[model samples]
Target: MTSKVHLPYFDHLLELLKDQNQTAIAAFGRHVHWGYWEDPSSADGSIPDFANAAEQLSRRVCDAAKITDGLKILDCGCGFGGTIASLNERFSNLEMVGVNIDERQLERARSQVHPLNQNSISFVCADACNLPFEDNSFDVVLAVECIFHFPSRETFFKEARRVLKPGGYLAICDFVPLKFSLPFTHLIGKFLTTSVHNTYGTIKSNFSLSTYRQLAQKTGFITRIEEDITRNTLPTYPLVRKLFRENGAAETEKITAGAELVSKLGITRYLILSFEAIDP
Candidate 1:
């Protein structure tokens, strides 16, 4: 199946994995997102350390969603089923479905993740903004570090609300710009367009926290959690850059460095946000 999105980073990772690159498999075989360290200073910058931190990041989002046993869940943009695997391990009797537009990633996910601890798992290739599930079918919907790649956040939010049962939760992590940074971000985005597209594909990182709240309200949801964990995610940049460099992706490394700079300057914030579906 043809994917609507074009993420070059994933293409590189898949190639490396196919070639039996052990470090690449170890670092990104599961989760393809940034890591979260409880204490940034204590991050040891090893493959194992980064992998553990990545798992922690997924758990943090799940915790925000108030995930419990026996709840039907949908993980949108579920790259390689990492979060689904994590959830399958921690919870029992869960009806879990992972949705991604890219079938290649879903193929790997299907091969790697299986039902465990009485949890059922399935991976579907579908757009985040156009889920194939029935309305009000899921108790929780998660989008971990992938909202920026969606065609439209507003549409995805509306779809998420539609798919969730009443009082169900939607949890996501994203790079949110501060209100004051929007103008500057737009200006910089124009110049970085080609480079960013070549490295990470289309990304929309100009959404501010206030805009998120407005989106939640407009989409029949109430904002529940908006925690900024940018500091904790800082340790991910160095490790990711090193990996990119080792893999001979100079353009990707340069783009990642730029992202790390903006993040360190507080121009962009990494946030975990959860919203509860409400009756309209």
Candidate 2:
């Protein structure tokens, strides 16, 4: 039988891509968009008013965990610091730190975020599984839509437990693998449609809720909340297709192919899991 994965840090590779693509705008990876809500909810199937939707998602998360003012927060795998910026506003006294593997994203985060706020928010180039911080360093650790990329779920959970205080919480909102090795086209669609990429490997190892919960539990985190954001993201298909079409057929085909792959692979869901770290 095969053993569970335990990923190693690549010290040399880290320095090479440290400051590659720092943009002058916000951190949406591809675009400078703030919220991940380019939806089509109206009669003409126009994009949904996701500003409210995005805010609600962020607010719900903060409210659920009692994330208040003046807490030291860590955003693991924070892409472009969008979540960090949003949460910082929600909590006026929040000391926010965003860590991303992509140097380009961190650069853009540094440039776009306010200079005064810079003191409050620090963006660093670091790996999620291997964080550079003392134990019990944060009050709350938020991994919004960015943890699956970690080479090992076990390593991530261990690190999360290490850095968080005894009662500190870990909230993750990202894609969960339902099964291992999804169709390549579905994997490709996920990237093209969402403007996100897979730096780790193929779309295989996409896990289910139970898979994630088990890993979290194994790492000593007590699962507190788990919700599916799949339906919310799923219904936006028409709008995504339309946008792809406007971009042209070749692009649309690639996007649709990815979409179909997700459907065929019985992988049509996204997840958000929240847990509290147990002190030994």
Candidate 3:
């Protein structure tokens, strides 16, 4: 990430999140990523469920990260410990830590901890840009659609690098615009969108795929896998549209539709990038 920072921090949203832990921005309470639907279009006329598809995207991230037994993982900006629960169920001998900026969300995440893995999975309230862990501590750091909310994604990149053991991986799931327009396209997207999730309130989360790749390289990491899963995630718009309507936000329909349309046209992308740590 270049030092010519263009975006602002999300400090103001922290003030608004005191009691919004149970608030479900997406259809599910646990997930917030653009869900991965095998068929974005409802050609078969099957019932669409948001949480189910969101789990698919989580699995995709886990697969790309090659999560396995005996590996320690960090879920940075982990909304409600969904990744922890998912991975804990799949792998037996795994140790996990989940961190969220908000204490309220961290409380909920801590509650999700299983009795069996209570000794293994732990949640901490901390800033992602400044993780509260030692260097070379974890085998992997997974940030699912939450980096954009951080004050400085570059700082978080450095922190992830610092905490990861050599040969460890960083997996990120985020929305990447087609063009690399800073402070402009992202600014407009916030106005058009509905809920004003943590990052959109400050426009801190505004980088395209190309920009992220460049930043990773600049931060001393190797991009091992970059997948554009727009097709798999496009189906999430309808779910978000319903959420906006159910909350009496009638004006967000157009904005949600616009996002979906732009994504289909390749002007926006839902991407999963896996980077491996190496000597810089």
| lDDT of every predicted structure (CA atoms) | 0.95, 0.60, 0.73
Q: Sort all candidates by lDDT, best to worst.
A: 1, 3, 2
Q: 1-280, model 1: which lDDT tens digit per residue?
A: 4456899998888889989999998999999999999999999999999999999999999999999999999999999999999999999999999999999999999999999999999999999999998999999999999999999999999999999999999999999999999999999999999999999999999899999999999999999999999999999999999999988999999989988999999999999999999997
- Which parts of model 3 have CA positions greater than 4 angstroms off? 1-26, 42-48, 115-119, 180-200, 251-254
> Please, what are the lDDT tens digits per residue for candidate 3 over residues 1-280?
1112221122322222334633352334566566787776742212236677878899899888878888999999787688888888778778888998766666666765573543388888788888889999999999988887788888989999999988899999887876755555667766754444422343344677777888889887899999989888876777667655665555455556776787777777788999998886
- lDDT accuracy of residue 240 in candidate 1: 96
Q: lDDT per residue, candidate 2, 1-280, as tens digits?
A: 1112221111211222344423211112322221233342432433344334445555555554558777888888776666776776555777888887777567767876652432388997888889998999898887765565677777888988999998888887766555543465355546553332322222233566777778877887889887765555553455445544553444434544565357445575566678898877
Better of 1 and 3 by TM-score: 1
Which ranges in model 1 have alpha carbons more than 4 Å from their true place?
none
lDDT of 2 at 255: 42
> Candidates ranked by TM-score, best first?
1, 3, 2
How far does residue 271 in candidate 1 sit from its true spot (Å)?
A: 0.2
TM, every model: 0.99, 0.71, 0.82
Question: Considering every candidate listed, which one attains the maximal TM-score?
Answer: 1
Give model 2's TM-score versus the native structure.
Answer: 0.71
Q: How high a TM-score does candidate 1 get?
A: 0.99
Residue 191 CA displacement from its true place in model 1, Å:
0.3
